[model samples]
Target: MASDRKIYKFDEVVHHNKTKDCWLIINGKVYDVTPFMDDHPGGDEVLLSATGKDATNDFEDVGHSDSARDMMGKYYIGEIDKATVPLKRTYAPPQQAQYNPDKTPEFVIKILQFLVPLLILGLAFAVRHYTKEK
Candidate 1:
């Protein structure tokens, strides 16, 4: 059945990433998810997040039910050109922890570290003073 479908290039699919016109590739097949975005059981964000990208892993990782898999036929627009389809899809690199000590002034943090304990102690004393017998 897929052999009869139109073939789309990688560059052609990338152009439809926007919310207004979303497309996704899964297992070398292209799907026009724009119309079904709102009706998606997982909500539009899940579909939107995968727009214009190869979502085969993401889709399979979610463990979609048989019915859900069957429903994909409705959105089937075409198949990605086999010659252009990548064996390994590109993924965003994991974000590095952003705890640069040099980014923040050490003196300001030190001041807060000192003042926080003092403020807590002061609040405790104030509460005690007001609650004490006349």
Candidate 2:
């Protein structure tokens, strides 16, 4: 069981974020991926970029295959101590749109003024052309 696995502090894992000593925390499990860095399809840079931080989101975003997930055990060293990690927030807050009350009405008026005239002119031209002899 993973419960019997070694527990590592996030601070300790952070120190191994180099090319020669890379470690990553993904979904709470720690991986010493240095041995496989050169063989990484996305390259060592991708693995290096996820270092020193909880990379669960980054890992999940890439949508790795089942085999890729299976390969994780090869480098599995331990699990990170969740309590040692500083922030626990999982997802980021949704961004709110800023309503520019000062310019919204003015901008809409200017756009409609230009668009309405163009639309009317286009309609007139089309109607005149269709009604002509040809």
Instruction: Name the top TM-score candidate.
Output: 2
**lDDT by residue (tens digit), candidate 2, 28-95:** 99999989876899977788778878999999999999999999999999989999987953432222
Candidate 1, superposed: residue stretches over 4 Å from native: 1-3, 86-134
After superposition, candidate 2 runs with Cα above 4 Å error: 1-3, 88-134
Backbone clashes in model 1, listed as residue pairs: none
Model 1 clashes, total count: 0
Tell me the deviation in Å of residue 49 in model 1.
1.7
- In angstroms, the error of model 2 at 123 is 67
TM-score of 1: 0.60
What C-alpha lDDT do the candidate models reach, one value each? 0.78, 0.83
